[model samples]
Target chain A: MKVKSIQCKKCAAPLSLHGGGHRIRSLTCEYCGAIMKVQEDFALLGQFKDQSHPDCPLSLGTQGTIKDVLFTVIGTVSYRSNYGDSWTDLHLYSETHGYAWLSYQLGHFTFTRRVRYLPSRNMKQLSPREILRVNDQPYQFLEAYQTEVIHVAGELTWIAKVGDTSILRDAISPPFMFSQEETENEQEYHLTEYIDPEAIDANFELEYDTHRSFVHPAQPFKAPIRKALSKASLIPMALSVLFMFFLTLLNMGNTVLSERITHSQMTGGLFVQDFTINNANHLVEIQFDNAYGSRFQVKDITLFDDTHEVFTFGKKLKVKSSTISSQQGTAQFKIKKAGKYTLRLRAITTRKWANSDRITPYISLTIKEGVMNNRYLKYLFYISIISFLLFYISRYFFNKKRWE
Target chain B: MPNASHYINCPQCGNQLPLTFQYAKLTVCTHCDSTLFIEDDGVRLAGKQSVLSTIPSLLELGSPFSYHKTSFVPVGKVRYAHTIGYWEEWWVIGNSGKGFWISVDEGDFAVEKPLDLDSRDVASIPSRDDLYLGQTITLWKDQWQVTEIDKGKCEGFQGELPKILKVDDVVPFVHLSGQTGQLITLEYLDTGIEAFQGEWIDPFEIKREG
Candidate 1:
């Protein structure tokens, strides 16, 4: 079968067949360590179809016929040295240049391997001492795909297109460098994120099976913890029902009280004052007369919880042209505890104050007791019963399941 | 039964993975991130996978089985067959039957639909040097030879293969010769749409006297 040989496709190393049937479809090339296949029709297929991820500095590999053989090599390293520690280079060349310098070393290891082109005239040839040092270090570049060493020992020979080093350079362009610091900086923004279920499961299974694995304590679903979880799930539902009942009663009472206030009219003053607390225990109403002449505007009204300013009504309030009438302002503050409070009232208008020493109506308040609607009591009763029912129902279910 | 099979090597790391069955469209070496395009043109470097299969029923095989000569001219144009769904296949007659489901063709390149991964779709279709959507590509050996580029077709719709084609529409034919390494020959269909032309050298230039 006259098929397109893999050796003819590459530009570097010769395909030295390593004891394989020539008729076989695919064979590994000994020179470049690349697996060559013979396809009847020449087609540029996918690269890395059967190969591992390329290591930073790749190893050597080849394709195409022996006369047109090409080998490729690639690797990566990090350095703390002045020249930035690591060097990565990939070169491709024909096999005619048999002897190749793998790499060089001053202290540790520095050099090149699987080389097809010689040093340019600008490059200095290694001295005997330098050669000895490189030989002593004895580092050979690996083949590009896998972790295989590259070592060459032979007489030198010249091949066609020795200057085609640029082809290899074009084949394996330098990859973008991401330093360690930059990589970590990038990860900081992405670290506090969720991993997919498969990834989490894999990590848990691989690294910490002891702690992460679900322990089957004889019976899987019949454990006491299962009963606890089942019981706990009912608590929120019962509490929600009781909460809704109290909210309804409070809404009903507020509606009834607002209706009674609507029927009262302004009498004996510019604003009439009326106090109605359904089921009132003790409530008081205070009346204030606007003393400032020529209709003073209401400035700011602030409700304070002692030193804490709770609410402030600072929007505009208009007053009519009357000063002798009783100015009515009602504060329906719910007092959780009976206490005395100073209600400061300040009224100012741009019409101008005639007397600077004139005193405005400010009152001191003391609430002995306030009305309590059945809504709150009803809410408490409902919550207590629901909570008790939930607890006992859960306990009963737990006992029934666990005692089984 | 199996979709396509490609024997490829890692261009960067020299790793090799024979992509077979549904996995032929796209795959990455867990070791390296080098990409791979399933085609029949350019160089099949180490770690590259080429499918080895005969043309399937859907893939049309045109004239001239075999002839050895130095000068081979691409007879006609290699037109792109744009179908809607993913059921379309590109099978070649190599030593074995090989082909791929070209699931996507952006402006510049053609990509194969991948295997059943976590996401039931292709991770990504790789870009080949010569083959692009709407362009006529040739088959070199077992790869694709991008010959002439035709920007004639409007941007294609995105969808699966079977959904795209009418049941009556014919599958395009891929042609090759020992004379020229690649040739994509498309049939003149009455489907009314214009066909993309591949590399065509005038036949009168060479003497067939031998």
Candidate 2:
């Protein structure tokens, strides 16, 4: 590459202005370190004989390529916070694309470019929970403050005077950072992104190790890992929901063996019914449709397989209102003979106000038998729950890696 | 306004004035403090009397500095007294022959240039009472705040100013600050309205004329 012919005003050292320095107003001497103001010629502006810049591998005039575009180093400016934290901004210029910056802090690099547009909302509208979205990506607020220019060097498009301050607000979405810097004359928005140094070095065919391993603030997880995790999380949940729907559709139909449709008024006596089981190892469902919302008194409710005493229980239900409902009892067992079985219930039914002469509450009963796989579906549901938890945990960690 | 001339004498006080430009519409007689109006015939009394007094400042006429890529030399100054104290405004002539201003209140300095009405969005001039500190007004597509409000009178004048200034003239003005320390000063005078846009530049960042 050809270099411009120029001379430092102070030390008379040979210097060259690269990357279209036509608008540049200042350049520092590489020898005596004198700040020179450029116009038709050059004039000495200041001196910095003692201050040292940040130690970094790249220096002024380092040329590098990114995404097939070549960028030349032109200048570097340093800014400081009130707490004394400082960072250097390397201004890079492309002959066809104009200017951009690389923020260097402790070996970390963030590629930045000026933003061309902004959201309509103002700064005050940015809430803690709010993530301002641009290009379908949400940007979370990081910090905001006024930073002072502490140091400056090399050729620049505009005059960068030390001690000048600017208002800045920063936000980030993994791999990307958004900033608004307001100088006295103009407000500019910029976007910064984290790039893998290994990729950059590999693309440029450089021998140096630019691979940084430290966790940067806006560094993103590997694309493949995040994409796979997201897919693993979503696909299983969707399949489980669809399977649940299928199980529900199959479980809706039940075969009724016996049901009493006629109203049977209880006269405070015991009632017994002999029912036969047609199949072995099947669920026997006994149901009672109750009305009048009355207190039910039943004693020694029992089921017997030819007096073998299969199952016995007792219960009492207190009546509340006229809006009555049904009751059910289910038992799944092998009857062995698949023959005669008797269900017996001793009960007294009455209303809360006996003197009111409302007719005694009528009771109804139904018996149903079916082959059910409710237990298996329940086990599958629990397994799906575990998978849901696993997916979410992976997602949480993935998002943390991507954004924090 | 008359064309350029070498020299002329004040009609009221017979003070010889070294007039150089045709656009020097209004000037002061240094010997008698009489305001003179330069016209085609000659320098005549501006029909005004001013008992002016000077204020001490760090920057005087002919002080040169570079700002916004333009080299300028301070050519004029106007002093105004407020309720709290006094502030001075200096008009600097640029290499392009255009004019700029530098305001000094206490120790702060602001580099300024005149703004046309088309550069602002506000339709009408706001009343003095309507302007308060912390109020915001948009100009040149950026928001600026009214940081100061003062009712002052012209206390002193010197050199060739963009506009005429007479002692004891009512100069009600407001100072606005942008988010990044830019300044917008609006001066309301009986003759007309004037607006100047500027930014607060640090003295340490400036390199004096060598």
Q: Write the per-residue lDDT of candidate 1 for residues A1-404, one digit (tens) a residue.
A: 12232352333444433211112233333233333333333222212222222223223332222112222221111122222222222222222211112221111111222211122211122221121112122211111111121222111121111111210110100111001111211210000111122332242232222221221111112345545544564565456555666644543322111211110121221222222334333332222333333444444444444566433434533445545332444433353333333333355443532457464332222222242234454565565556546655755664344223
Q: What DockQ does each listed candidate score? A: 0.03, 0.01
What TM-score do all the candidates reach, one by one? 0.19, 0.43
Strongest candidate by TM-score: 2
Candidate-wise lDDT, in order:
0.28, 0.65
Ten-residue segment with the worst summed lDDT in candidate 2 chain B?
A: B201-210
- The Cα RMSD of model 1 versus the native structure comes to 25.4
Measured on C-alpha atoms, candidate 1 has an lDDT of 0.28
Which stretches in model 1 have alpha-carbon errors above 4 Å?
A: A1-276, A279-359, A363-404, B1-210
Per-residue lDDT tens digits of candidate 2, residues A207-239?
555655455666775656545555665565566
TM-score of chain A of each: 0.22, 0.57
Model 2, runs deviating above 4 Å:
A5-16, A29-32, A55-57, A83-85, A106-108, A115-142, A161-163, A171-176, A184-186, A193-198, A204-223, A244-404, B1-210
